[model samples]
Target: MIYRNKTEAYWEPLLTIARDELGIHSFDPMGKPSADIRMCRVEDIGRALERAYDLGLMVGHTVTRAGCVNGECA
Candidate 1:
Protein backbone atom coordinates (compact mmCIF):
# COMPACT_ATOMS: atom_id res chain seq x y z
CA MET A 1 0.00 0.00 0.00
CA ILE A 2 1.15 3.53 -0.82
CA TYR A 3 1.65 6.06 1.98
CA ARG A 4 3.08 9.47 2.78
CA ASN A 5 5.83 11.13 4.84
CA LYS A 6 7.12 14.66 5.54
CA THR A 7 7.41 15.55 1.83
CA GLU A 8 4.80 17.66 0.03
CA ALA A 9 5.57 17.12 -3.66
CA TYR A 10 3.86 14.73 -6.06
CA TRP A 11 5.77 11.52 -5.26
CA GLU A 12 8.53 12.70 -2.99
CA PRO A 13 7.51 11.48 0.48
CA LEU A 14 6.95 7.91 -0.62
CA LEU A 15 10.67 7.33 -1.27
CA THR A 16 11.52 7.39 2.40
CA ILE A 17 8.62 5.13 3.29
CA ALA A 18 9.52 2.72 0.49
CA ARG A 19 13.17 2.52 1.45
CA ASP A 20 13.24 3.17 5.20
CA GLU A 21 9.92 1.47 6.00
CA LEU A 22 9.07 -1.03 3.27
CA GLY A 23 12.69 -1.72 2.31
CA ILE A 24 12.14 -1.42 -1.45
CA HIS A 25 14.83 -0.27 -3.83
CA SER A 26 14.55 3.31 -5.12
CA PHE A 27 15.54 4.80 -8.43
CA ASP A 28 18.43 7.13 -8.99
CA PRO A 29 17.62 10.76 -8.17
CA MET A 30 17.14 11.77 -11.77
CA GLY A 31 13.90 13.60 -12.56
CA LYS A 32 13.78 14.01 -8.80
CA PRO A 33 10.99 15.83 -7.07
CA SER A 34 11.64 18.95 -5.11
CA ALA A 35 10.94 16.78 -2.08
CA ASP A 36 11.77 13.05 -1.90
CA ILE A 37 8.80 10.67 -1.97
CA ARG A 38 9.09 7.26 -3.67
CA MET A 39 6.77 4.39 -4.49
CA CYS A 40 7.08 0.70 -3.50
CA ARG A 41 5.56 -2.75 -3.90
CA VAL A 42 6.17 -6.39 -2.97
CA GLU A 43 6.27 -7.27 -6.69
CA ASP A 44 4.92 -4.54 -8.92
CA ILE A 45 7.59 -3.23 -11.24
CA GLY A 46 4.90 -2.51 -13.83
CA ARG A 47 2.96 -0.45 -11.35
CA ALA A 48 6.06 1.60 -10.68
CA LEU A 49 6.46 2.19 -14.38
CA GLU A 50 2.84 3.24 -14.61
CA ARG A 51 3.37 5.66 -11.77
CA ALA A 52 6.25 7.22 -13.65
CA TYR A 53 4.08 7.53 -16.73
CA ASP A 54 1.33 9.08 -14.69
CA LEU A 55 3.79 11.63 -13.37
CA GLY A 56 4.61 12.82 -16.93
CA LEU A 57 7.83 10.87 -17.34
CA MET A 58 8.34 10.48 -21.05
CA VAL A 59 9.86 7.15 -21.91
CA GLY A 60 12.37 5.27 -24.10
CA HIS A 61 14.98 7.97 -24.17
CA THR A 62 17.76 9.41 -22.08
CA VAL A 63 16.83 12.66 -20.34
CA THR A 64 19.21 15.52 -19.71
CA ARG A 65 19.22 19.23 -18.85
CA ALA A 66 18.85 20.07 -22.53
CA GLY A 67 15.71 18.04 -23.20
CA CYS A 68 14.36 14.55 -23.89
CA VAL A 69 16.97 12.35 -25.55
CA ASN A 70 15.98 11.44 -29.12
CA GLY A 71 12.39 12.70 -28.75
CA GLU A 72 11.73 10.49 -25.70
CA CYS A 73 12.43 10.88 -21.97
CA ALA A 74 12.33 7.53 -20.21
Candidate 2:
Protein backbone atom coordinates (compact mmCIF):
# COMPACT_ATOMS: atom_id res chain seq x y z
CA MET A 1 0.00 0.00 0.00
CA ILE A 2 1.17 3.46 -0.92
CA TYR A 3 0.89 5.75 2.08
CA ARG A 4 0.62 9.47 1.45
CA ASN A 5 0.53 10.59 5.06
CA LYS A 6 3.93 11.57 6.45
CA THR A 7 4.16 9.14 9.37
CA GLU A 8 3.06 6.01 7.54
CA ALA A 9 5.01 6.89 4.43
CA TYR A 10 8.15 7.20 6.52
CA TRP A 11 7.72 4.12 8.69
CA GLU A 12 5.96 1.59 6.49
CA PRO A 13 9.06 0.81 4.45
CA LEU A 14 11.22 0.32 7.50
CA LEU A 15 8.54 -1.82 9.11
CA THR A 16 8.31 -3.98 6.00
CA ILE A 17 12.05 -4.42 5.90
CA ALA A 18 12.10 -5.31 9.55
CA ARG A 19 9.46 -7.97 9.01
CA ASP A 20 10.63 -9.41 5.69
CA GLU A 21 14.38 -9.10 5.89
CA LEU A 22 14.92 -9.44 9.61
CA GLY A 23 12.16 -11.99 10.30
CA ILE A 24 10.79 -9.80 13.06
CA HIS A 25 7.07 -10.25 13.59
CA SER A 26 6.65 -8.52 16.91
CA PHE A 27 7.81 -5.11 15.82
CA ASP A 28 5.85 -2.25 17.27
CA PRO A 29 6.37 1.43 16.63
CA MET A 30 4.95 2.43 19.98
CA GLY A 31 6.81 -0.19 22.01
CA LYS A 32 10.41 -1.28 22.24
CA PRO A 33 11.42 -4.40 20.36
CA SER A 34 12.87 -7.45 22.09
CA ALA A 35 15.61 -7.82 19.47
CA ASP A 36 17.23 -5.43 17.08
CA ILE A 37 17.00 -5.81 13.34
CA ARG A 38 20.32 -6.87 11.90
CA MET A 39 22.32 -4.28 9.98
CA CYS A 40 19.81 -1.53 10.65
CA ARG A 41 20.98 1.70 12.19
CA VAL A 42 18.81 4.11 14.16
CA GLU A 43 20.61 7.13 12.68
CA ASP A 44 19.97 5.88 9.14
CA ILE A 45 16.27 5.41 9.78
CA GLY A 46 16.03 8.85 11.34
CA ARG A 47 17.67 10.47 8.35
CA ALA A 48 15.39 8.60 5.97
CA LEU A 49 12.34 9.70 7.93
CA GLU A 50 13.47 13.29 7.83
CA ARG A 51 13.92 13.07 4.08
CA ALA A 52 10.46 11.56 3.73
CA TYR A 53 8.96 14.41 5.69
CA ASP A 54 10.69 16.95 3.50
CA LEU A 55 9.51 15.20 0.35
CA GLY A 56 5.98 15.04 1.65
CA LEU A 57 6.04 18.72 2.46
CA MET A 58 7.18 19.53 -1.04
CA VAL A 59 4.52 17.35 -2.63
CA GLY A 60 1.83 18.81 -0.39
CA HIS A 61 2.81 22.34 -1.37
CA THR A 62 2.69 21.43 -5.04
CA VAL A 63 -0.72 19.81 -4.78
CA THR A 64 -2.57 22.19 -2.50
CA ARG A 65 -2.37 25.45 -0.62
CA ALA A 66 -3.94 24.37 2.61
CA GLY A 67 -1.20 25.48 4.99
CA CYS A 68 1.52 28.05 5.19
CA VAL A 69 4.86 26.96 3.83
CA ASN A 70 7.42 26.68 6.61
CA GLY A 71 4.99 28.71 8.72
CA GLU A 72 6.38 31.78 6.99
CA CYS A 73 3.44 33.00 4.94
CA ALA A 74 -0.15 32.04 4.41
Candidate 3:
Protein backbone atom coordinates (compact mmCIF):
# COMPACT_ATOMS: atom_id res chain seq x y z
CA MET A 1 0.00 0.00 0.00
CA ILE A 2 2.95 2.26 0.60
CA TYR A 3 5.24 3.18 -2.28
CA ARG A 4 8.32 5.34 -2.39
CA ASN A 5 6.99 7.28 -5.34
CA LYS A 6 4.72 7.22 -8.35
CA THR A 7 7.37 5.48 -10.41
CA GLU A 8 7.83 2.77 -7.83
CA ALA A 9 4.12 2.08 -7.72
CA TYR A 10 4.09 1.74 -11.49
CA TRP A 11 7.15 -0.46 -11.76
CA GLU A 12 6.52 -2.77 -8.82
CA PRO A 13 4.29 -5.15 -10.70
CA LEU A 14 6.58 -5.43 -13.69
CA LEU A 15 9.53 -5.97 -11.46
CA THR A 16 7.61 -8.63 -9.58
CA ILE A 17 6.94 -10.36 -12.88
CA ALA A 18 10.57 -10.20 -13.78
CA ARG A 19 11.55 -11.68 -10.47
CA ASP A 20 8.82 -14.17 -9.85
CA GLU A 21 8.28 -15.49 -13.35
CA LEU A 22 11.62 -14.90 -15.02
CA GLY A 23 13.81 -15.78 -12.07
CA ILE A 24 15.68 -12.55 -12.56
CA HIS A 25 17.17 -11.54 -9.26
CA SER A 26 18.93 -8.39 -10.33
CA PHE A 27 19.48 -6.00 -13.21
CA ASP A 28 21.98 -3.61 -14.70
CA PRO A 29 21.26 -0.79 -17.06
CA MET A 30 23.93 -1.74 -19.57
CA GLY A 31 24.27 -5.38 -18.70
CA LYS A 32 23.92 -8.13 -21.24
CA PRO A 33 22.19 -11.42 -20.67
CA SER A 34 24.40 -14.05 -19.06
CA ALA A 35 22.05 -16.93 -19.48
CA ASP A 36 19.28 -18.21 -21.71
CA ILE A 37 16.23 -16.65 -20.10
CA ARG A 38 12.69 -17.70 -20.72
CA MET A 39 10.66 -15.04 -22.42
CA CYS A 40 7.27 -13.97 -21.13
CA ARG A 41 4.43 -14.59 -23.49
CA VAL A 42 1.65 -12.19 -24.35
CA GLU A 43 -0.60 -13.96 -21.89
CA ASP A 44 1.87 -13.36 -19.10
CA ILE A 45 2.03 -9.67 -19.86
CA GLY A 46 -1.74 -9.51 -19.97
CA ARG A 47 -2.15 -11.18 -16.62
CA ALA A 48 0.41 -8.99 -14.91
CA LEU A 49 -1.19 -5.87 -16.29
CA GLU A 50 -4.57 -7.09 -15.21
CA ARG A 51 -3.33 -7.84 -11.74
CA ALA A 52 -1.91 -4.34 -11.50
CA TYR A 53 -5.19 -2.90 -12.61
CA ASP A 54 -7.17 -5.02 -10.16
CA LEU A 55 -4.85 -3.88 -7.38
CA GLY A 56 -5.19 -0.25 -8.50
CA LEU A 57 -1.53 0.24 -9.16
CA MET A 58 -1.82 2.15 -12.40
CA VAL A 59 -1.47 5.88 -12.89
CA GLY A 60 -4.39 8.01 -11.63
CA HIS A 61 -5.26 5.21 -9.22
CA THR A 62 -6.22 6.20 -5.70
CA VAL A 63 -4.85 3.04 -4.14
CA THR A 64 -1.26 4.04 -4.46
CA ARG A 65 -0.52 6.97 -6.75
CA ALA A 66 -3.09 9.37 -5.35
CA GLY A 67 -2.86 8.09 -1.79
CA CYS A 68 -6.58 7.52 -1.47
CA VAL A 69 -7.52 4.63 0.74
CA ASN A 70 -11.14 4.15 -0.27
CA GLY A 71 -11.43 4.93 -3.96
CA GLU A 72 -10.39 3.13 -7.12
CA CYS A 73 -8.80 4.71 -10.20
CA ALA A 74 -11.50 4.31 -12.72
Candidate 4:
Protein backbone atom coordinates (compact mmCIF):
# COMPACT_ATOMS: atom_id res chain seq x y z
CA MET A 1 0.00 0.00 0.00
CA ILE A 2 2.05 2.91 -1.30
CA TYR A 3 0.15 6.14 -1.31
CA ARG A 4 2.00 9.16 -2.64
CA ASN A 5 1.56 12.86 -2.10
CA LYS A 6 3.07 15.79 -4.01
CA THR A 7 4.69 16.85 -0.73
CA GLU A 8 7.28 14.32 0.34
CA ALA A 9 10.62 12.69 -0.21
CA TYR A 10 11.61 9.89 -2.53
CA TRP A 11 10.89 6.36 -1.27
CA GLU A 12 13.82 4.69 -3.02
CA PRO A 13 15.99 4.91 0.08
CA LEU A 14 13.33 3.56 2.39
CA LEU A 15 12.32 0.82 -0.03
CA THR A 16 15.91 -0.23 -0.41
CA ILE A 17 16.26 -0.39 3.35
CA ALA A 18 13.08 -2.40 3.66
CA ARG A 19 14.52 -5.03 1.39
CA ASP A 20 17.81 -5.16 3.28
CA GLU A 21 16.38 -4.79 6.78
CA LEU A 22 12.87 -6.22 6.79
CA GLY A 23 13.08 -8.55 3.78
CA ILE A 24 9.93 -7.05 2.35
CA HIS A 25 10.01 -7.06 -1.46
CA SER A 26 8.10 -4.41 -3.37
CA PHE A 27 8.57 -1.89 -6.26
CA ASP A 28 6.36 -0.18 -8.80
CA PRO A 29 6.21 2.78 -11.19
CA MET A 30 2.76 4.09 -10.43
CA GLY A 31 3.35 7.62 -9.27
CA LYS A 32 4.16 11.12 -10.50
CA PRO A 33 7.92 10.95 -10.07
CA SER A 34 9.84 13.69 -8.27
CA ALA A 35 6.81 13.72 -6.01
CA ASP A 36 5.86 10.06 -5.80
CA ILE A 37 7.27 6.57 -5.33
CA ARG A 38 6.33 3.26 -6.90
CA MET A 39 5.73 -0.14 -5.30
CA CYS A 40 6.04 -3.76 -6.33
CA ARG A 41 6.28 -7.20 -4.71
CA VAL A 42 8.59 -10.17 -4.97
CA GLU A 43 9.08 -13.42 -3.09
CA ASP A 44 12.66 -13.02 -1.88
CA ILE A 45 14.97 -10.42 -0.46
CA GLY A 46 17.62 -11.02 -3.08
CA ARG A 47 15.17 -10.43 -5.90
CA ALA A 48 13.81 -7.35 -4.22
CA LEU A 49 17.28 -5.96 -3.72
CA GLU A 50 18.22 -6.67 -7.29
CA ARG A 51 15.12 -5.09 -8.77
CA ALA A 52 15.22 -2.07 -6.51
CA TYR A 53 18.89 -1.47 -7.16
CA ASP A 54 18.31 -1.77 -10.87
CA LEU A 55 15.45 0.64 -10.74
CA GLY A 56 17.49 3.10 -8.72
CA LEU A 57 20.29 3.00 -11.25
CA MET A 58 17.86 3.39 -14.11
CA VAL A 59 16.26 6.38 -12.47
CA GLY A 60 19.68 7.89 -11.97
CA HIS A 61 20.32 7.56 -15.65
CA THR A 62 17.05 9.29 -16.42
CA VAL A 63 18.02 12.18 -14.19
CA THR A 64 21.45 12.42 -15.69
CA ARG A 65 20.12 12.81 -19.22
CA ALA A 66 18.20 16.01 -18.44
CA GLY A 67 20.27 17.00 -15.48
CA CYS A 68 21.27 20.56 -14.63
CA VAL A 69 24.92 21.22 -15.19
CA ASN A 70 25.18 24.97 -14.52
CA GLY A 71 21.91 25.46 -12.68
CA GLU A 72 20.04 24.43 -15.80
CA CYS A 73 19.43 21.27 -17.78
CA ALA A 74 22.51 21.80 -19.80
All candidates' lDDT scores?
A: 0.49, 0.54, 0.56, 0.59
| lDDT, candidate 4, 1-74, per-residue tens | 44565244457665667767555455544466743343445555556566668777887887776576545563
Clashing pairs in 1: 12-36, 12-37, 13-37, 14-37, 14-38, 15-37, 15-38, 58-74, 59-74
Clashing pairs in 2: none
Kindly indicate the candidate among 1 and 4 with the higher TM-score: 4
Clashes of each: 9, 0, 0, 4
TM-score for model 4? 0.38
* Ten-residue region with minimum lDDT total, candidate 4: 34-43
Better of 1 and 4 by lDDT: 4
Candidate 3: Cα lDDT at 60: 46
Q: Candidate 3 on 4-41: residue-level lDDT in tens? A: 55465547665676576455454433343544344677
lDDT of candidate 3 at residue 40, scale 0 to 100: 72
TM-score of candidate 1 against the unseen true structure: 0.26
Which digits, one per residue and each the tens of the lDDT, describe model 2 over residues 1-74? 23355475436655554455445453444343433334656766566566656767877786565445446455
TM-score on alpha carbons, each prediction: 0.26, 0.37, 0.40, 0.38
Q: Which stretches of candidate 4 lie over 4 Å from their true place?
A: 1-9, 12-43, 68-74
- Preferred candidate (TM-score higher): 1 or 3: 3
